[model samples]
Target: MGGVVERTDLGRGDDPLIGRVLDGRYEVGQKIARGGMATVYQARDLRLDRTVAVKVMHSGLADDPEFVSRFEREARSAARLSHHNVVSVFDQGDDRGTLFLVMEYVPGLTLRDLIRKDAPMDPGKALELIEPVLAALAAAHGAGMIHRDVKPENVLLADDGRIKVADFGLARAVNAETQHTATGGVLIGTVSYLSPELVVDGKADARSDVYAVGVLLYEMLTGVKPHQADSPIQVAYKHVHEDVPAPSLREPALPAYVDALVARATARDRDLRPSDARVLLHQVRRVRQALDHGVVEDPELYADLMPGVRPIAEDTGEVTGELEREDRISILGADDVYDQDREVTTAMPPSGVATAVPPRPPQNLAHNQPPRVVPPPVVADEPRRFQQPKRSRRGLFLLIGVLVTALLVGISAWQLGRYTTTPSVISLSQSAAKAKITKAGLTFKLGKAEYSEKYTKGSVMDTDPAPGDKVSKGGTVTVILSLGPERHAVPTVRGKTLEEVQQLIADADLSLGEVTQAYSDLVDEGMVVTTDPKAGTLLKRDTAIDVVVSKGPKPIDITDWTGKSAKQAQKSLEKQGFKVTVDEQFDDTITKGKVISQTPNTGQGVKGDEITLVVSKGPELFAIPHVRGLRTNDARQKLEDAGFKVKVHHSSLFVGANYVVTVSPGEGTMVPKGTTVTINVV
Candidate 1:
């Protein structure tokens, strides 16, 4: 309805849309692969100039309104998931009834290819591969979404050493619309991987994904499928009725914990299995670590991972007829005992859906006789004419012991099933945390609010028993909500080193913003002088506070102010934060009040250092030697001898320049030593 719903035939013929562009962006190239309902093509994202995977739905599916609606929902769900181990969905489009989804193109083989070539792989290598798949599912589960279909076909091993899980919400779309494993009499999913719940009720959750992964793991450990039948429907029936067998049956070398891990994951009782993929992933990592360390016996790990109920029969494999007749007979009861519904037939159905069916008589068995696949055929009941009187005491005793042991095991398993671990819900919203806790069959109780810097306000901060701790299914889980970060006074950073203050800031739950340098007389170099907003200021945790660090005392440069005005020198030096000292002296050639000398006038000086200046005073005055009536040359000579420059001038009258008529500065006059004197000649 939102976009074009495909109506063309892409079902069973050469695709005509090959090499054609779709949505003006994704250039659909050649078909890479095709499945029952969709065809995959290697396409190029023209806008991004990168290769991507385009999956186009078949004709019947794309044309149906119900399927199209579900398809849109699936696209939104798949696009919401983002993880390193998940194939990212980029876009969803419909171009002229051709529905397609764009996804990250992984250039590598699928897990299916790996299993086809090198199945029954080493336990370590199998775990190494499956670990990433679980991580991807875990992310989806954490986001409140489920990957309904989990199988080897969806796991891609990229050439760049990345394992990505694909096709999220695809099964959900089909399942929601069809509500069965078969659509239009065609099988949609591989029946071998379906869980008991999925096979019976067509319902699934995170545990269903875990069950499929368990089956996947078993196939890796063994080279064949665990259950075999004449038809896919029979296999689905076996999924609901039988328990998945331990891998050790195929590979005896596998540790007990490995079997326990698989058993717990694939347990028919979903409650006994891990709550979700994340919980299962944790257990897988623990087991993998143990295997890596070569631990032969880890009772604790084995106990934790082992399924509450011990199943004596049922197995999965890649190929059919993996177990012989004798093996089958020893594992389960006769087929006739499974016949509960009289209307249903055990024979393979054409529709391929798993339905409870009456057990069919084996062709190889004698006429009118039940199957002997569960136990050894001790009595060949050939319709004997006469019956022999029967039983020995030993046989009776053996039967009694078997009944008692099975009863004890059943009771113990029921008790064990009641226990499940508390899942990690830290930093999740209060409603979300409660939903998950309750979904695990546990009760929820809100506890006191606590302050935490890591968690946000009203989000889950802590749990009473803590996550990963075992609790009864109906037991109450108390959650503490975060009250946000607590406020504290800024620490004392004055006179402390940068490193020390940084540590102090962290300890106080505060972060360092910017560090500035300043010259302080009291603080040493490379030490904190003060802090922005000063010290002892109350602030929230992780708040960035600016700091001021010291670069030692300020250095003052002496400008050598000699021969400059003493008043000007003192005033200019004081303005630069340096103390000024002045001394007075008399000089013959220098100005009377100008700076005559300075002390230590060169190089660098410390802050608050004193600068000295010497002021000039007038020179001593002596009698001018009264040169009136004396020869002009004699008067000039007398004035020049006294360090004073003398100038000669004649009177207005035409008298010979023999004597000085009047002498300027005639008598004693106080002046500087370099003062000039004028004389007149008659």
Candidate 2:
């Protein structure tokens, strides 16, 4: 109910539908069953003109990339299952955000329905119903698939009275990555039919399934389940502690053979039950055959069914009296040996014919009775009876002596046989005892551990023989398993410097081993860094682990050489591992010969890094030009155009005319871009 509850997207306009039609060929119908991860629907395949069952996953999970991937993988896995008892998976698809599977639609009532009717079914018929189920389980389990949930609801009884196991939805493939169900919780199966192992440890095996089937068989015969506690937990506890009662004890009319089979299947010890589904299947067939042919009575089966009731005695040649003879060869036919309520009697003449005999006359009896006809004198009754009673006492004593002697001889022989019983020596190493046990034709069972502080981890803790107790050949000796050593959580060593982490490890009684480094933008430079084993992981004492430390980024420095030759600058810095940049220029005061100002200014930190510089070459100069024309200032402007700044002057030599002549610093002289010149009129 907590999984996929609604079918809004899967439903039609008014009708509820969940899956899409495949190849434009099949139209999936409404949802028929819903599970924690997927929903099943009945569909019609148009191309084949047949009906099919479609299992559509919940929309929420269908959208999950991981779930869809696993769904497709499981579909393929289910397809590989070709057993007749297993339902066939025909197709699978991921359409848009929906995932679904097309399967065979089995039309029939589930085993749950038949069980709920609460009527006694023929024991033989019940066996017949379970036989094929066991067969299916055998094949499925043999192929490494475990039907985690084996319950009445999952077993379909077809109209033709054939059984087909359905819903491998919870089944898991062994030795595969899909062993765990999608939902990660304690993997206990359905409560009512859950095995004891499923209850206690949440681990299931073939024996666990055997236990569930046993419960089913019990229910079939008695019309009642074995343990009926208010809750599943309580019932599970009873299964662990209480030995299951035979079905015949609860319903006396049921055959004892059924009880024996159920008891074996439901044995609490996993090893005591059938090893796997195959063995269980064989047993089921055997028992089914016996039941079908009316060969169901078992000689040793009565112990559990009728514990205190003495079985009807078998005939022996020793019985001599008329009543003994009548019982030995029961007067009735063998068919009448057992009556529904009481033992029936039928007259059988000595000749084996059903004939009656007439009574004889007294006169005929007197004719040859005795040779003496004389009558003895009658004495008072007490005196004669007392003497006769003493004779009877003597005869009784003789019989008692004979019985005691026979019993003593029988007991002596039994004691001699018991002396040959081998002692059960356990808790010694497995190999040490294996030889001796095998020699004696005995087996051993291993038990859970009982911790010991004195003995070493795997040393002998205790034994069943207690050093000298005797046991018979083939007797089981259980050795206790070891729990190894105690340990504590390794302290958090992350974020600490390498020295500090090592010191912490030493303090915790552990040792530092290999050290590896990795880039971490978060951690600081040159600090003790994190460890690979992580911190706070519980490990055994003296365990060695690897640690990692950080190394800061490499450093680079800035350098300068201002007035040096560009070539000289390159040579000076190259020697110090620094790159240089240079540019030439003219200076007013500094000569073209030497270096001027240096950067990374003197006495500053010289990291021999990159350097940029400016150099001086020579002084600034200008050129002069000649111009003689009216308006002397205008004449100076024309002279300045020839490479010198304007220097205008008035001319006194000519009347009403002012002109300019040659100037000093002649024209065409190399000069600085901005220089001025003076011109005077003469």
Candidate 3:
């Protein structure tokens, strides 16, 4: 959308119906162009909300019932065609005697405009423009609809560089009943581009369209029509009596093969031209490839493009015969004529030639004058000459007969040996392969089918004699088909043991690859956790499948702590993967900082095992306040008995006084039994 620009008009202001809307759906905006039978307008499809080109038939033609019926029929036929290079016909309707066709509106100049702007284009560019047009015509021809009119004006070159052919069946409708003018009568096709058959008899077919394209291509490459005249009748006469000259004559630098292409397509004898636009399309592609490869002369390709010798005077015409014979010499060498059945002929006379006429009136002077004397006929006598003996003549005839018979036999044998070969049907479906084989004069039989990695099921894989191998005409060829890829699905072996999984893999046409062990919560030990390329995975036959087995949950070891610090012991046990719990207890022998005992102190346990540790609280203590009033020795003995040490301090003035007058001011207190007690005496 960012790069696209919407076009609202076709830049024409002379049309009267520029702003008119028809059928209550199309909002006609501007006039694109006017043709012989219709005037195209840029219009919007209000119902579909899209831009389209509306081709409205001339009011006079629309008023005719026969023309309208044919128009509608041809419109439907064109609508049935679906191709990338064709302009799509969307809808057809009539509003108040105005017949119109809604078609895709391409936003670019027509090929006619391109030719006018860039005449004498290079051969490569000329082929590029014509290829898509041929493709469009090929689609129509394949669908049994002939594009009676194929010219540059009908070929649309879109802004995106896409070439599309427009007016698929319009030409047939316009030329259906052969409109005649008050002046000299002529056909509806463009004069300069009309085919010889069309101009002569007003009859057209796919080959006629091919002829038009050929003329168009010639004009593109030479900037002029192959035949030109002031009047349409005269131009039509040349088309019938003369052959289209090669493009190289006008553009002398053009390749000879290019000339051959033009000559083959525009041959005055329709039989000599491509049978249809599809065949012409193939020839065009081959010529384009040759040009791209810079091939200046390709006699082999030229012979193929224009097969067989040019038609003689008996086949086409003296004028055409002479030109074809000369063209073939330059196009394909004189010695390179490929022999083929000559089945086509141009027998019709030029149009407006007045084939039917009334008898002329008798002369009135013959009755008034006396009859003149008639002369008697006379005969001349001739002399006879003696001939050879009958026996000698018979002997000469017999020898000639034997020589002709031998020549026929030898030619037939060579043809059978050289032209017959097994056609390639590999990768084709069975029905398609059979059709090809039968068409090639060969019998086909279905042979054994085997699994293949490349071809689809039921498609031909190989042949008995192989494709391109020499075979006799009507020889039998056996075909082998594919059964599709050979693949096996991995079997489910989640709960199966290693040995059982291996056996299952083998049963599934697979090999046991790598076996790995891993701890799994769901699967038990020695059981498969899962198989690589898991269950139901399609793989090639005998593909290795990895397996993972389960090991039981891992075990952890507990550390002993009979004499280690309780806090340090709890940290050490937890680090070893055990849950630790501490309990306080009074122990007189064991140190207070040491762990007295532990639960599950030394054993193997899984992760998350609890280990309880009991720590020592030291000896019990009692109040020593009453010991301060007694002597130092007595207090010492009391404190020591209570698991405490006692000391006496003497004052300097009362050194001899060891009384308890001033004992180190002590009161009733509870402490660890190992605490020391001191007393003062004065």
Candidate 4:
């Protein structure tokens, strides 16, 4: 009500509705403005891709079905009057029992801001700004709708230089309900602009809006409110009994007719004022015309603006302000004015018409008498307010009244305020929910908390006896709070068996998913190596965790290299990541430098294992023994001893038995180790 989002305070995190998306369409953002009655929020219309302003009603009013019904009904009525000067109502909704209204977001400042900057402004300038406001009101009045709340805060000055009226029919929606006193004896609506009749009886029509505009005009001219008092109650008291002073008292340069315009509109009696905004707009144009003509002395226009029948204050025009709360009936603290049913100052009859004011209750009555509230003075033609009815008429009315009272009591016995219904508190904070329950005369019971993904931690998740359910007076209301989402840390399962790993996962509140086996030299066969998500990861309940298991050292088949080229074998084995070594030995039949045998040639080994190849180095060589000129028998014995086969031959020139000759094969020759030598005899 104070203004829109442009010049508002920065958003706060504690406001529950700050980040909420209503009806899955409007993303409610920051707090724009806070007033006595409602909160305004900057929001985005996700569907339309535009910004909007959302007005959220207080919990006390939103929870009231009767108030909600009136609000919705009046909202629909306001939406029908599509004036460029009026702020458009885009939609109205109840999101989880938090009632809100979406309206066009005008980016600029409020008239309140303008007033703060340029009060005591030129009359023509003031008229220029207010003329559009009156046109807006005139259109609504033409549509037979009354804007019960009209004030500077509800008027917007756009960045594009357009003036608009906002929150139409909102005050009427609040006032149309049975007049009820809110907590702390607080009043409703902006107090400075409240009409005398509205303060007196909580009733308003088009003329009431005219009165507020009159107040606006007066403040614009004088730069101050007409009434001043110690408290809001005192201000309301003055609206009822005092008259609004002329603006000329503050600024003497003004013509008297301007004074008359303010005086006539702010007249204590509604009958003396213009019937509606249209009538007032016509009068304003006449005054503007006179001002344009520079007609300083127009007693004719003055007389026309202020008839002789109406009374105008010629007081000092001193500004009246201390603490102005709600602009309604001032009967407060003391019993200045009151009646039964604290909800409303003036009680209504079945016909929906306000009854005549009851006589003020006697103060300091007999000790045995109960207390009574003094009622406001009634609007009546008769002067003798204390006059009693005739005895005969009184007797007949009393008998019927007694019977009606008895019947009403008998019918209302079941309820009769003996119980209260549970308020809608879903999604509210725990403290806030508890406050509502306790305020409704129900006990606050905290049930077990639960993990919830939808609700924030420490906020209410659910409730027993639910919203709108009737509960016995002082009955306990059980509420469940959110503990946030469920999560657990995955346990370490490496080096564990399959059964052990499954048990560990289950203990961690996780499910076992696919299990894979891999070769691990360190871990034993069929043992878990590690988990896929790894150990110590925080995961939601029942989330499947995959694991890797060890199948022990892998087996590698070695190729047999016996009787093969040793160089080729070494190359093949080394290329396959195996370390190779060689061994050589002389052989009689194998080729030189060929493989004789391989160690563990048929066994299996993993990669990086060692392989041994035995290669052939060819046959051994020896020198033949020298047996020339020796006895043949001796030579033969010596050849046999030298590991060779001996042969004896007697030549034709042989010496005789045991004679020696040159050996056939030359002695001292390189030959095979088993080569034979022969000696000749003559």
Candidate 5:
């Protein structure tokens, strides 16, 4: 077969075993998901007796020396960092040649999956979803780590519904190192979430991460993307050319504040946008809080405009409905029955009286009776004449009081609207629940069913609001549904010890239904040879299973080795996989070349064991040289050079053995080389 490609499997399948020792220490379990670089598996750590996710590179990639080294190094770096939000890297090693990274296995769906099922969240809720992401990013940023990919796929939603960001530094490692082209081409990260700067320059900084997060926020607030295109490249172009549309445009009921937030986040000019995730997060949170209160945020500017700059034009007076009509009336000449009394005499009523009243005749109207007989000194009642007219005092006061009461009522109604409760739909089937909510004049959101042992499948477990609460129209309500009993993926129990294999099955929430033994040379005793259902196959709870174990390889007997030649002894020991060592010595009575003593006696040694031996050569033999009288020093030297020990019993006698007076082993005398020789004095 051709070389296999290395990658993480996002889909379900069997985890392919590579190298030797299928379950030397860890019991391989079910396949979780696959990524561009490695395939992650849910496995049991036999040593620690805990479950973990193992990410193993494909044999093809692991075989590549460069990729393996880089993978190991990157794993080490990621392992050093520990944060609540970051997925923890626990261990990395090469079992034989299959390189793998073991990390804390988180059991949860990804944000991408969450978004796929439900999206375009309510403004308040969307902000809640992303706030934790911002917090995680902040922690990573503080540590000088950038999460190059901040898309929903990289965000995991735990069972508690809290988001935990994953794959922070993994992308850098994958991209920095080239991959086999015909193999798993391109890295695993989703391309849609990439920032423009990352796409163009292949560089991602805190700002770039911030940009990606902004994109995610945009998608969450708006049901769709800021701009969606047929291809990734087209989407990228739109990101650059198109400004983020206000969410209110899609859902007009959305507050303007939310729309502005999306606009600022997806600003085409990176410089014009928030410089970092911290700033973006703060703004997003503020909008989220203010959304409920109807706060329309104002855009930030460099400076408050300097005031008091005199304007060229005067302020046009505010023209109310009444004022506007008055102006129109003046321009069109009042359609009244009479003009301003200037030509009143021309038009007379049936009573022969002009409709227009004549203006006062240039005289102060101080006199009570129009200056009664003006000649009779006009005594003026100036106070009453100059007093403001009170022709309709009662009617005006009643109108003013009614206007004030209406204003108060309108304000109270608005306050009541703000406090209305979110609606609820409980104990209904999925279709029924949706219908009821829609009929009640609210949007319906369907979430993935969480497996529950207590509730039956397709039944609603609970709703966001308790049943029978008063919620404002258009308010969102979340419902939890049941998927009956939880299903587990039966782990591949092949090549594992019986004890270890049982633990794996249990960790997967499966039962050790039965165990069966079998004889096999390839598998060790008590080790699982194979299992039914194989691995990576899903099974419902309480499913029965069978496991086969190895009895062990046949045993080998010891061989005897004595009185053998050195070469024969070495060869015979090696054939049985025993390490051999040799040492030679001289013997006085034994003939030449025979084994003397052997460790363990060689009769009881097992295969693959070690043995030591002491070998003996022929009897000792030597030649001696004799030296007569000479200089005392020279005589001693000659006697000693003849392979003999010179002794002086009584050196006081003129010249003792010190002058080599006589030699016991004389020159040319035949003697055993191993024999000791001595010379005597006087």
Candidate 6:
């Protein structure tokens, strides 16, 4: 796949491996791009006679055996995928000390470059670009792999207008053991594309990739990330706690269904999102269909795409009943009592007013024991039933009395058993505390946790009811967990830049307490030398992280030392921390053993800088050559070739004779280069 070239300090020719062959198969060519993990170079597959791209890992990472193994494994896994939208991985091998991967070389720019040039793309175009990316992810996910780092830079746009995805399983491999941080402690994936679950718990699955794609779609349609903040931490927090605003909020021209699609895919709760890339791909197609149909308001489609609203559980009905009972008890005054006898009497008919009662004669005399009685008459065709009716009414009244007594008793029993004292769960682990609460027939709730030195992290520090406080059965018991000691480990920041050190301090929840400067030969200037407490020291949060920075190698100024003895000059330069190399030569003017010249005659250099000194070895000397029998031209040519400045001298009378009498410095002599030689011709 053609990846977007990330801007970096390195140029195309910066990599030393360029133009070198790896494994005697792939010949590395010009660098195509450089990223945090590796440098991509255009290469030639010599055996296959085809062009390929070779990605060479950085030395620092390749040195780690674990990381290298993981990298190789992931490369193999990615190679197994045969989707057309995926960049093909052909080979992986280590050459000498360098580890590299040979992949298909696509000829084009990256999605990142496209976004920079033409963004806020039309809805149709945005969907078109995202569809293929989803398909590639779908294939990877189907193989039980995840592209943890999904961003525009990994999405490639080929010259032929084909879209492809790169670096399929690399992020997962890197992030396997721990949260992978690139140089300067920035996360491996782009912060803008990080999912909420990844930010909060450092966990990711297929849904996390879906969330990233949703963010991608939003950026493509709106020209900006859905969540924006001053720092990555803040942006990550927003992703955890806030829902991504609809795209229409930024670009009102976007249809509502598009916003709904983004929302569903990026929902903070993984359960509410599409389960995997395939499901999200299906949703993408539906949205595309809506856009193609030119539907203005597709509420039905929007609803279908929206996350399912969770329904209240049936167990909540018990809670509602308890609440209602409590409300009724509070409303009813305890002092209020009813007069049962008066109530019964008020409900019954008056004896004197009732004409249906049986007729009777009262006794006249107090002393008389006998009394006269009379029976009631019935209506026509009906037997006398006055006494029976009265009996029936009396039976009904008794039944009502028993029912009222039973209702009062049941209410009293419920009130008596309604509440119980909460049990102590302090200093217990979260799971144990939850089990205890559940055993007590009460619900458990996790409340805000605070740092406590007395309790370990993830343990219950306190409860709402405080132990032994009255609480109803099935009542919620909110417990505050301890975050443990409020301490953070000092992170390794040596060799990092000042800004990077500051970021590391902040990420560790520590303050940039103080910055000191010092000269370091090993560390580059403006980079960190060491921290006060060093790395991996545990201390309270916000603890000052004093850093010592490098001022680079010490600078020294060179002084003029012409005519000085070579040995003395070498000693003087060496004492001043300069590396000196002396060269002996025959000088015409300077005395023997005296310094003739020095490279970088007058300049300032750092300690340990190399300085070359040229020492004199006296004037050149040679025996005169016997050229009496030789031709004059031959003698002159031989003299000139033997490290000499030749000067031919003709005798006054023998100007035309082609014979030489003698030559100066011509035989059996060692002379300095360019020494003067005189030849006499006769």
Tell me how candidate 6 scores on lDDT. Answer: 0.72
Per-model TM-score, in order, reads 0.48, 0.40, 0.46, 0.48, 0.41, 0.44
RMSD of each: 16.8, 26.4, 23.1, 22.6, 28.4, 27.3
**Per-residue lDDT value at 24 in model 6:** 85
Better of 1 and 2 by TM-score: 1
Q: What is the lDDT of residue 628 in candidate 3?
A: 48
lDDT score, candidate 6, position 579:
88
Which ten-residue region of model 5 has the weakest summed lDDT? Answer: 341-350
Worst 10 residues of 3 by lDDT: 339-348
Q: lDDT of all predictions, in order shown?
A: 0.72, 0.56, 0.71, 0.73, 0.57, 0.72
6, model 6: CA deviation in Å? 1.6
lDDT head-to-head 1 vs 5, winner: 1
Candidate with more favorable, higher lDDT: 5 or 6? 6
Candidates 4 and 5, the one with greater TM-score: 4
Where's the lowest-lDDT run of ten residues in candidate 1?
Answer: 325-334
Q: On residues 25-139, what C-alpha lDDT tens digit does candidate 3 reach at each position?
A: 8898877765456677888867546688888877877896546655766776787687889998867777888888888889988776787789999999999889889998899
TM-score of 2: 0.40
lDDT of 5 by residue, 1-682 (tens): 0001111344344435522233375666766665434566777766446677777766766786545544544555565565677676655667777677666667778665666567767777888888888888877777777766566656677777656776655655554454333222232233445555553345557777777777788777665666565333344444433455556666777765565555555554466456677777787777766776766554432111111121122323331211111111110111233222111001001111121112112211211112123234668676555678668788888998999889989998886775445444444688888888777777777776655433478976555553444456687667767776567898877777778888898788665655777766677788898877677768644344567888865444545455666567778778766777777788765455666766666345434566776677766656676555554566567656655555543334654335445555665677765334454444
Q: Put down candidate 1 lDDT per residue, 1-682, tens digits, no spaces.
A: 0111111233435668787899888888866665545777888877556688898887777896546645765676777686889997766767888888888788887787788789899989999999999999999999988777677778888899999998887766665555422333222345667777765555678998899899899989886666666544566656755667778887999999998888888887799889999999998899989999999889999888776643233322222322222111110111333322111111121222322332322322111122235554587667658779776699889999999999989998998898888887877899999999989888999998866444579998677656766688799999989877567688999988999999998787676767889999899999999987678987754456788999999887778888988888888788877888988877777878888889868988886788888888846566666777778788788878887888877678737867877767865765556677888788
Model 2 global lDDT (CA atoms, 0 to 1): 0.56
